[model samples]
Target: MTVIQWYPGHMAKAIRQVKENLKLVDIVLELVDARLPESSRNPQLEEILQNKLTIRVLTKADLADPKLNREWVDFYEAEGQPAIAINSNQGSLKAIENKIKSVMADKLLKRQEKGIINQRIKVMCIGIPNVGKSTLLNHLVKKNIAQTGNKPGVTKSQQWLKAGKTLQLLDTPGILWPKFEDPIVGKKLALTGAIKDTLYAKDDVALYALEYFVDNHPEKLKERYHLTDDEINDTTVNLLLNLTKKMGFKDDYDRASERLIFDIRKGKLGRYTLDFVPSSENDEA
Candidate 1:
């Protein structure tokens, strides 16, 4: 397995800025990719947000297994964490607003008792790179205020945006932790575009994706590439080479690897969930 590590200067600065601005916000909206709920979360951000009111926003639900989305939400909610899964492009965001208000109800009531009325909830939006943080922000505020891209590290700074009349969102650049302790976590991030393409070997992640599909969604993989049972059963490396030849790329395995990765990201094969909720907290290791 290839070791994946990418933490640039801007991310370090973003962490400092997040800590500095933590006092200004009433709540935190931690965004994560729906397919990789646990792996996509930044442990560094978790440390910075210590005891702060935070909601887990699982973005890109459309590209992830729908059943897993609900299960992940249940897993978080069962642990007493506020969480919701949304496609951001189409899912209703009313649930997010309602959850925020409900969580802050006590704080709001105290302010109301002191004669403060209609105070907007201040929230900080954060997530790993390319996990749809900016896209979610744009939908929440109903504008293209934050730059959206298919690549990582698009948003470089933080800014505030109004969501309707009640929520004020602080949009920050996607922040990844300095290191990934688990290699699977790194591969999952690389497969899902959370990590930049240049940061990891495409063949490594493509093989990882191929193995995942072979185990979990062989039919989709076979159908997508028109592979026979014997072909599908081939070893991962041989299958990759076969795919390269079938795609008319000849010996350019990198091109084939890139195609497989792009297809997975674009949902050409099918929706998938790389992370699963452990049956119990003790089972997490």
Candidate 2:
């Protein structure tokens, strides 16, 4: 399989540093976009933090389908993992705190048995860029303790925050894997805005997004633009252009495409998640 690898020198250094610092934390709170939970995960993380407990937080839940989010949560729980869907901007931090306590229950009990009182469980927050790690930190602490931006690579250094009496969070920069073994993985990352749009042409990204939406999420197109499946299949760009015109664009096809791309990125079409997990039958590929 051809892999797309783009790990900047700084990120490699960061990963090495994180690996070296993993011993300082008691748990890892791995943040992933709820919309693209499977695709958003960094596979290398499992190997790096092999023996540590991990609590997966699916951030940006408001922008993902509720039903799919529930399914994902169930999937994780069934695998003996703790997972929660949450929106960083909304009032979901309390639930996150409760889940953190739940995941660290065993460790907390061990500390209690050892006569350790008022011990704080240190958690390292790790995820890919734009997964809302910093936003989550701010929400949990009720203050802007971490530097946050709308784009990727905003948080560059690691800072520790006290989430509560029982938990402390080590916030780190969002990190991407050194390589994407699957092309679809790279495509989904781009589609979900994990990779900056400035790195590639909007039209090309939109084209791939258009095809994926048409194939896996035809109902979203129908609901968002009143486009029928046949209309969507006929011509993706033209269908988008017509929808843009109806939405009060200047009736220019190129402009319409641009607007459609913007809407897709901003979750205007609907809460949609892209799946890129390779099937078991095709695992060799």
Q: Best candidate per lDDT, number?
A: 1
Question: Residue by residue across 191-228, what tens digits does model 1's lDDT show?
Answer: 88988888888889989998999999999999999999
Show pairs that collide, candidate 1: none
lDDT of 1: 0.90
Tens digits of lDDT, candidate 2, 160-267: 898756678898888998777777777768767788766545555566677878887888778877876677877766766666667776565555656666787788
Superposed model 2: Cα runs more than 4 Å off: 1-5, 216-219, 222-230, 237-257, 276-285
Cα TM-score per model = 0.96, 0.86
Q: Model 2 Cα displacement at 283 (Å)?
A: 11
Q: Which candidate is the best by TM-score?
A: 1
Give the poorly placed runs of model 1, Cα more than 4 Å off. 280-285
